[model samples]
Target: MKALTASSLTGLALLALTGCGESVSNRLMAPTDGPSATKAGTPIMRGLTSSAGVVPTAYDGNTSGDGSSSCSALGFGSTGTKVDGAYSQKVGGYQFTVSGSEKQYLAFAPSGTPTSTILAVIVKGGDAYDVYNYRNNPRTSDAGLTSPYNHGGNIPTISHYVVCYGPYTPPIFTKTLVGVMKEGATIGSMEDDLSWRDHPDLVIIPWGRTRWLDWQLSYTLPPGVTGIITENATTVCGSLGTFRLQCTFNENPATYPIYTWSGLSGQGAVLVMNDLGGGGAGSCGDHDYTNTATLALSNGTTLTASKTITVRVVCPTTP
Candidate 1:
């Protein structure tokens, strides 16, 4: 298997061929070529892609051997089980594919706003590894010259690097990192080169919160389906509170029913209808009379400006 960094392939191969292991001549090379020229999976050298996508495995805190039963035991697959090739797994509706060695898994929390969290589990062939807090970017913009990791000794060629923010939290899952380093791939080489070689291309894996809502579901407003717009709201039908008016609509066919309304109101509220009441704008309310949800709209229907929406609800006496 190849190391995370491709630059070390040549020299590492030569050293292995000569049988003179861990020699000085084998180390140190061009910045782009990596310190060693070998293709082995080191902790930092391995790359993981879940069934959902490719996630990174950092070597900074990995502990594994090359070609060991424990290290080789790790892999990713579509089923989240051990496979011959790199394994891939789907956890929390996300897919990942992993390659290389000395692998480990981690979980990360969200950024500045901490309303959500990400849960991920790392796996290997023989045993499951530890899961640690993965995303914690505590980095300040460096005019693009300084290394992000000064806490460690000897830095490699990096374009840019940033520290994760927030406190460190351990993984809730039982697994740690799985997989071992490949032949001729050493931990030292990975630290000096692959781990953060090119900060610009480092590809930081954010183990933080992922959006629950499918924000990509934007469609044109259809006809027959009215677009409702409201302004600052104070009463929501005698609820004794101030909130925004809720709106809902439906689609034809009703085969694949999907609903999306109110970007401002509380999480799951029924949209009001035909009015914003106290000094609001336009019309707003439930669009779908059937049990179905219309995601798209026909032509000739007008939509109100989204900026005019303020979701404040108050109690309605007419209740």
Candidate 2:
């Protein structure tokens, strides 16, 4: 098998899997430095959207369910990068100071999360909070609105929360994790993401199977950025028998964090970073970085997705 490089997301020797009857040997063509392809490429998956109910589009600043409003019904339309579950990649969340004190409003789109009615979006400013959820319909699903959240007033150090019950096993959500925006502004000051993609957009998985899943992932890992996805994950002994972070590439090919996972089916991680400036590749300032990752499944299918995460750094000063 040939090696997979992250610099070129579109080109690579594909790993073709052959199936025999009801069972098959699942495998992913692994890179030269990491584990063998057969070890990292098994085909067993997981999911986070199993239970929920009908939800209204935009609620009127109330923790409890309030009235609703649709963009079409009110002469508005929805438009943007519309994908099913694209929001799944944004597990760590984003935070950025949008404007330099300009009077604006926030329009948000929580991708791939509208289908789960059990989910809720809450915003906190000063001492009060509000709720806004996605409207899973033909007219609205890309983004949602937490509008007039400031009333053109002092936009205090605001905070946003995306939470869901039942499936969350008591909701271990990152309270301040969110992707917020205004009419014309950035989502937040710090945007962290791991945009996971599956090929054949419409391909459905065969349920109740344990041998159909193996994965090989490649990331356009940036320099001077140290965070969850960039560093080696922690796995204590005896923590076996379930899905966990298998292994990450140790900068073998340069510019990419090639990795493999036992199962990323229903996993979420907080994106905490340390821009300590010891990497020697990064300077103090807002770094607008564009990264991408390609996930190779055991079924011989590959998926690629790109993301733009802008992180600002402040260098330490000495006497």
Candidate 1, residues 241-319, lDDT tens digits: the string is 2222222212222422223343321112223221122222221221111111222112112232221112222223355
TM-score per model over all chains: 0.21, 0.19
Provide the overall lDDT of each model, using Cα atoms, as 2-decimal numbers: 0.24, 0.26
Candidate 2: misplaced stretches above 4 Å? Answer: 1-257, 263-282, 316-319
**Measured by TM-score, how close is model 1 to the native structure?**
0.21
Residue 316, candidate 1: Cα error in Å is 34
Per-residue lDDT of candidate 2, residues 1-319 (tens digit): 8765764432221211122111122121122332222212321110011112222222223232211222122222221111111122232121211222331112233244333222333333333333333232111122222222222123333334333211211111121212321111354333222121222111111121111111122332112111222222222111211222122222334543333333332234333221211112233444443333334322122344444433333345557
Which candidate's TM-score is highest?
Answer: 1
